[model samples]
Target: MGNKPLALTALSVALGLIAGCAANSSTTSKAAPADSGEKAAATAKISPNKPKNDYNITVNYELGMHCTGFDFTYCCVLPPYNSVQSQVIKTATGPKKYPELLEADEEDHSVVVDDDAGKRFKLSYGFVDNTYSEGSKLAYWNVPYDVDGDGKYEKNENVANAYWTHLYVYEGLKGANPKGTSKDSEKLFVGLQIPVPLDNGPAGAAVPSPMKGGHLHYSGEKGTIVYTKSPVLDNVPIVLTNPGIWDALGLPLTPFDDSLVRTNPLTLTEDLVRPFQETFVSLVDADSGKPVIDSHSGKPITFVGTSPIDVPNCSRCHSNETANGKKYTLYKQERA
Candidate 1:
C-alpha cells in the first residue's frame, strides 16, 4: 500500500527502453536521461509468442476502455481518524461540542460541504502509493484513500481518494537486459482505487448519517486518461478504470455507443465479447480472420462499434503477438 517509491524505478526503466532502442539483437539502445518522465515508461517485454524483427515495428496501442469482468465491493466504515481535525467554528451561541468537533476546530481543517444538502462535513485523509498491472503496461498509481470514510477525502487534510487518480507511466522491453529485466520485473503497477471530490476542494462534507450510499461510487463520465508511446507497451491490455479515463479520449458517450446493453461501458459483459470479435479475429491471420458471425446463426457478427481492423492489435501478429495481456495502467490523462 505504501509503494509510491517503486513507481519511480519502473518509470525510469520504461523511459530507457522507449528513448533508447527496441529489443534489437545487434545493439542495446542508449539509456534515457537522469531526469525525464518519458524514461519512466519504456520498460516492457515482447509477448511470449512475439517474433523478433529489425527496425521499428508499426503497431497501434489502441488505448480504449474495456471492463475487467471482475467487480467487487467493500465497506469503508467511519474511523475516529485524527487526521481530519480542523479549525473550530465560532457560532453565535458559542463554540461547538463533541471531542471530534473540538479536534477539527483545533486543527482548523477546512470543512467539506455536501453537494446534495449543502451541509458541513468533517473527514479524514491518508496517502498510500500502490502498484498494479494493466495488460502489459507496468504502472504506479498514487492511491490515497479516505481511511476514515467519515466524508474525509482531501490532500490538505493530508488525505487522498479511496483509490488512485495519479498514475505513473512505465515502459517495458524484451530480452534479458538487466535494465530491461529488472525494470520489467519490477514494472507491474497493480490495482488502484481512488474516490474523491470534484476538484482540489472537498465536495461531499458531513454527509447525512445513517445514509444509503453505494459502496463503489464512480461519477460517470468523470473518468479520463492520457496516452504515450513506449516499449513496455507492446502487449498491454485496454481497460477503462482511470478516474478520468473515459472522458480524456474525447470519445462520444451518446446513447448510440451504449444502446446494445452489452456495448455499454456502464453494463459491460463478457457474453458480449462478440462486440470485439472483428478486432479480435483480425488479430488472427488475414486467412484466419473470420467475419463476426452469429453464435445462434452462421451470419456475420453485426452490432454497434463494429469496424475494420487496423494497427496496434492487427500489426502485432507479424511483429509481436496478439494484444492479449493485462489492462494498461493510468498515465497522466487529466490535469491536476
Candidate 2:
C-alpha cells in the first residue's frame, strides 16, 4: 500500500507546523554586525494580556505486533488488528508557559483542560472518517462466510456480528450481545474449513494455517465471552452484555462516548485500507457547547492530525530465496 509515503507526508506536515508555530510565537532578534564585537540586542518582549492557547494531538498504535502479511495460511496468520490510542495536550502562551493534560469527562460527555491562568475550557476528540456506526453493513472481507443457515452466504450487515467474528477468528476470544436473538444480537458464523498447505520455503515445511470453525461459549463471567470448541462449552445459555463486546473491540462502551468523541483505544483497520487516520481536536465552551474561536484566526481553535501505520514485512528479507533466486538461511553464522 501507499502507507509509507502517506506517513512521511504527514510527518513532514507536522514538522512544518511546529516550525511555523515556533517562529510566530518566539521573539525575533536582529542580526549582529560582523565589524563590531557587540551581540545583537534583544527586543522588548510583547506579552499578551491573556494567555493564548494552542493544542496538539498525538495518536499511536497500542501494539507493534500488527499482522501485515497477506498470506493467511502462515503460522503467524493474523488478520490486520490495528488499534490506536490518542492524547491531547493544551499549552498556554504567556509570561509563564503552562502545558496541561486534557481529561475526558464522562459526566458532561466532554474533555476538559485548564490553562496556566486557571481558565478552564472544554475540548473534543474524534476520527475524521472510516468509522462505522451501529448496524452498518461491514465489508465482505470482514465476514466472508455464511452466518445464517441460508444456502447463500449471509450478508454481514450488523457491526456487532462483525465484531464477534473478528474476536473469535483473530483474537481467539468469544463475544455475545446482551440483546436477545434479535437482528442486532446475532453473531457471524464461520463455516468449518480445512487448511491448504504451501511449500514456498526450503525443505517443504508445512506452513501455519488459519484457525476456523470456533464458536463463542460463555465462560461464566458476567461481561466476558470465551472461545470454545468442545461440545460441553457449546451453547451454554448466558446473558451477554452488548457493552462487553463493544469494549473488547476498542469501541466506546457508553452512548456518551461515541466515535465523535472517542478518547482512547480508537481502533482502525490495519490492512492499508485507511492506514492514515485523521484526528481532530477542538476547543469548546463548556456551557454553550460551541467551539471556542481564536482571536488571531477568527475561527475555532482546532488541531488536525494524522496517525499513520507502517507494518514491516518480515518475509521480504527473511525468506528462503530472494527475488533473484538466491538461497538464504534463517540464521547466518557470524564471523569473529
Candidate 3:
C-alpha cells in the first residue's frame, strides 16, 4: 500500500480539533522536553487503568508482536485460553453456562514481561479489535471513567474522548526505532493508538502506515509532550499467495530489535492523519521514525508493552449486555 496524504481540507479540520483538545486535556504523565527516555521508565512503574479520578487514563497500544497473534502470519487466530471467545465456548460446553451474551476480553490480551538482564517491560493494555462487537465496528476500548461518581458509567468515559487532540498523551519511546534500532535502547517510548472511529463503510479500511509529515504527541507518566520522529515505511513485499506462510526466499531474514542499524529521519507533512498511519495497530516511532517492527520476525511491529495499572472488570461492568439469552458476565470473579 502507498502512503497517501489526507485531503488538505480534511486535515485542516482534524488538526484544528486535535489542537483544541490537546490544549484543554490534562495527563498524569506529562512529557518532559529532552527527557522522554527517563520519563518512560518512570511511567512504566505506574499501573494501568489507574483510579479514574487520578485525572488520567493509561492503556497500552498493541503493535504487531514477533511471530505472534495478529501479526501478518497469525492474523485473526484467537487463542484457545483466556480469550473472550474461549470463555463463551467454555460457558456453552460447561454446566455453568451463561444463557446470554458474554462481555469477554478481546484476542491477544496484554501482559507484562521481564526480559533477561532485569529489564521489565509492562504491556497490560491493547486496542479493542472489531471482533468484540457484532457487525464490524472498529473501536478500541477506552480507559473507563465513572464520570458522575454514582458508580454507573457512560461509554464515552474511556480514552475515546482524547482522539485527535494535541493533549492526548501517548506513551512515548525515547529512542524509538520502528526498524528495530534506537539511540537509547534502555528508555524507549511508544505512542498511544487513539481510538478514533474510521468510517470506511462497506469495504474495510486499511490500517494506518506512517510516512513523511506525520507527527503525534507522546507523553510519559510525567506527561511531557514531544514531537514524534518520522516513521520508517515497510519496504518488503508481503507474499500472500500461500496465506499464513512466510516466503523464505522472497524476504530478508527477520532482524532482532537490537541488531538493526539506525536510518535517517524522513521529512514529514503537517497532515494530522499522518500519525494515524500504521502497519496493523502499531504507532509511528518518535526516534527511528519508523513503524515498530518485531525483533525476531522483522515484520512491522505494533507497539507491544504494558504498564502495571489495574483496570476494572470489563465483564462485570458490561454485565447488562446479554447474549444467547444469558448475562455476559462470564469472567471469573477473582480475575475480575
Candidate 4:
C-alpha cells in the first residue's frame, strides 16, 4: 500500500509537470508590463468623468492558454477576463476614450495590458482563479506606464499604476443567502478593492471594507482622483458555528467562538463582514491622473464578473461504471 501511494504521488507530479510544460509553450510568447511608473502621486484627488461616446477607442482582449494540475486543487488557471471592460480619459481639451489591450497567459503567469490609454503605459496583470469558490477571481494589476511612447512597457517608469481587485459572482452565495433573503442584497456580484502603490501613500494605511462604502482620494497639482467601491447597505448576519464559518460565504467567523461547543456568541456587522454587489476600480491616466473610460460603451471600462458559460466538466471524462461482471471506475473530484 505504501509503495502504491508513493507511485501515485510520483505519477501525480509527473502528470502535473507534463500538463504545466505543455501549457507553458502557449504562454512564453506574451509579455508582462514594466515597473517604473507604479508610484502614486503624493497629491491626487477623487474625480470621475462621464464616459464619452464616439471617442474612437476600443480594446481587444485575448486569452492565451490554461495549465492543469493532477488534482482539482493545484491547477494554475486564470478566470476568463471580464466579459466587459472599458476605460475613459479626460484631457484639457475634451474627454477621450483610452482603449485597453489585454494579452494574458495563465500557464506562464505572465500578463501585459494597457492601463488607461493606448501606449501610455502597460500594467502586469497577475492572476489565479479561486478554485475553492465558484466564480471568484482575484488578481493584481500594477506597473509603470509607457511614458516615452517607445512601445516598451516596463516598470521603471516614474509614474506607477497598481492595485488589487477581487471579483465574486452570485452563484457561490446561493446557499449563504438563498431566496435573496436580505432586503439590501443586490443579487448581482461583489468585489474587494485595494490600491497598492510602490513609492507613494502614507505608511500603514487603513484598509477599507468592501461591504462598507468608502473611497480613496489622492490629490496632486493636476486634480483629485477617486477610487470607489459600492456600499453594503443590506446587512446579513452570518452565523458562526462551532465547526467554524462554513464555506461559500467565507466570512471571518467571530474570533470569540473559541471552543468546539460554540459557547461564545457574536455577530459581526454587515459593513465589516459582507461584500457589496458592485464595486469600481481604475488606473488613472498618468498625465491627467483621472479614471479612463471606454469610448464605445461610454462607461468606465469594466470586466465581467461572471465566469464563462462553457467550462469543461471533468466528471464527463472521469466517470464510474459497472456492467454485469465488469467494473470501470476512475477517481473523482468536485468542480467549483
Candidate 5:
C-alpha cells in the first residue's frame, strides 16, 4: 500500500513520455514513398495533434497550516493558508528545459530566468468555487467571541458565541509580533474581518459573523501591496494602488490592476466533505500581456495542483463512544 503512490507516479511519467514521443514523431518529417497523395494524407492527420505553442508551465502548492483546531477556546486554532510557486519554460529555446543555463562559477544548481519576457510574465491563482464564505460550513464555524474580555462570551442577535476570540491576531507564539514596528510585519498577522452579518438564529435578526474575505497587505522592498480574496473571486488578481509593489514583486503593472493570466475556477472543496483545495496557474505573454494558451486544448496553458487541509474529526476520540464512555461535554457541545 505504501508503494502504490510511487508506482502510480512512475506509470504516469511513462505514459506522458510515450505521448510526447508520439506527438514529436508525427510532427517530424518522414521519408515517404513516391506516392505524393499518401504523404499528403499522413500530414493532414498529424497536423491536428501538433502543438501550437512550445511553452510549458509547472505549478506546485503547499499548505501553510495543515491542521487547524476548531475549538479555539480549548486550543490554538489557525486560519486557512497556502502558498503556491511556479516556473515557466519555453521549450523551443534550447535542449535545457529551464530558461537560463547554469553558470560555470555558480555553486548551486538553481536556475533563474532574468530575461525581459520572464520578468513581464505574471502568474495569478484563484479558487473556482470558493466555499469559505456564506452558507458554508467554515463560515458557520467562525463564530463570534468575547472580544471585550468579559467573563461572558459575546452574543450576536441572541445567538451565544461558540468559537473564536479576537477578530485579528498575530500568528507567532502567544500571538506576539516581534517585528510589529516593521512595515513588513503585516504578513505575519492573521485575522478574520466581518464585513457582512451572518444569520445566526431568528429571521431578520443578523449578527456580526466572521467575514472570510478581505484585503491582505504585505510589505515588500518598495512598499506595501494588497492581495484580496473574496467569496466571489478567491486569490485571483491582486489589487494595489502602488506600482512599486508590482515592480518589487516582479509582476507586471497593468491598468486593470490584475494579471491577465486567468485561471479556471478551482472547484476542489476545503471542508469536511473534501478537505482539500486546488489552484490553477497560467502564464502571461510578456508582449501581449495575455494568457498563454495551450495549442492542443485551445484554452489557457494551465497546471493544476491541490493543497491538503487536515480538518480534524474531533468526535473520533471525544464522542460518547470512547473506551470509558465518559462523554466530554465541551466536545459534545461543539457538535451540537
Candidate 6:
C-alpha cells in the first residue's frame, strides 16, 4: 500500500531565535500577549510556528495503494484535471455524480466545470459524502492553489495573505506531562505539510504512532496543528447545490454503499478517511534549509484530535451496495 502521515514534527533549532526572546524553562507559558507581534514571538517558544525547514511532508491516498494516489482499488487515480461527469449520474443520487471533474473530457466525465480542481496538486484524498474513505488522489476540485503568480504551485506562506485552518482535538493531562526538552505539537500539522524543511529536527519530528489502533493525537492529544493548506487551506464553504463537494464527501454517486458508516467520536474514524498518515506527500522548495514552522509568513496554528463520525446511510440508488459496488468496490471508509 502507501505510506501514511504521522504527527511527530519538530524543528532542529530552538525557538529562542523565532520567539524573539529567551527559552525560560522556569517561566510557565502564560496567555499570549494581546499584541499579534508578541503573540507570534511567544508562539515559537512553547507552541509551534510557521515552518522554516521541511519535515518531509508526504501524503498518499487510496486505501492500501500499492503505490500512490489510488490503485486498482477505489477508483484509478482519477485522471489528472478530469472532472467527474454529471449526466451519466441518471441512476445516482446524493452527492457526486459518478465522477464529476474526473475525466479529462468534460463530455466524457459529464461535468459542466472546467479543469478538475485537484489536477495540479494531486491531493491524497477528498472529504465529501461519496468517497470519504476512497483515499486515492484527493479530488481538490475546488481547492484553489495558484498562489505565487509565478505560474507554479503555491503553499500558504507563498501568498501575500493566506488564511490558516486551525484544528482542535481535546486531551486533558496526557499532553501536560513533558519529560524532555522536545517541542510541542503545535507545529505537527505544519511539519506534516512541510516535512522537507523540518526533517532535521529533534526526533525527526516523527509521527509517534503509525497504526490503525487509536487516533493520531486523540482526546489526550491536545491542541496541535495537524493539517494546513495555502491561501484558504481547506475551509471551503459547503454548498449543497454543488455536487462536487458532495462527491468529495463520499456521495456514492452510483449505486454505492448503503451500510451504516462507522462514525464514532474519534477524529480519524469520525468520517470516512483514506488513512492520511499512510499517504506520501511531496514538498515544494526543499534543500534550502527552509523551516517547517516559520513565523516570518505563517501564524501560530492549532490542531486537535477527535473521533470519527458514524457513516451516513445514503446511497446513489438508495440501496445497500458497498463502495464501488457492482463496479469495483473499495475497502476504504463508506461515507453516504
For this target, which candidate reaches the highest lDDT against the unseen true structure? 2
Candidate 6: where is the Cα deviation over 4 Å? 1-137, 140-144, 147-151, 154-336
How well does each candidate superpose onto the true structure, as a TM-score?
Answer: 0.16, 0.37, 0.17, 0.19, 0.37, 0.18
What lDDT score belongs to each candidate, Candidate 1 first?
0.23, 0.36, 0.23, 0.26, 0.33, 0.23
lDDT score of residue 221 within candidate 5: 24
Q: Sorted by TM-score, highest first, which candidate order results?
A: 2, 5, 4, 6, 3, 1
Write one digit per residue (lDDT tens) for candidate 6, span 172-197. 11232233322235333221233211
Question: All candidates: CA RMSD in angstroms?
Answer: 28.1, 16.7, 28.4, 27.3, 16.7, 26.7
Candidate 4 segments whose C-alpha is farther than 4 A from its true place: 1-118, 121-265, 269-283, 304-336
lDDT for each residue of candidate 3 in 115-185, tens digit (9 for 90 to 100): 11122111111212211221121122234644334676664443333222221222221212245433333
Worst 10 residues of 2 by lDDT: 196-205
lDDT of 1 at 111: 30
What is model 4's C-alpha RMSD? 27.3
Q: Write the per-residue lDDT of candidate 1 for residues 1-336, one digit (tens) a residue.
A: 000121244543433343232344332345577777555435454322111111111112143332233346653432111101111111111122101111111122223222222233322121111011111111111334444355764452223333222321233211112343333333322112222222211112211111111011111222212222256563233333332110111111111112234222444433322222111011111123334232334554222122211222322232222232334323224233
Selected candidate, larger TM-score, 2 vs 4: 2
Winner on lDDT between 1 and 4 is 4
The digit string of per-residue lDDT tens for model 2 on 1-336 reads 000121244553453354245434346667678788987776856533333335554444344344445666756533233322334454444433433345433333223534333444554445455443222212223334443435565544322233333222212223443443323124323222111111010000111111111111111223333333344444333222221111111321111113343333344322223335664556666667677776655888766555453335534433424422555453444232
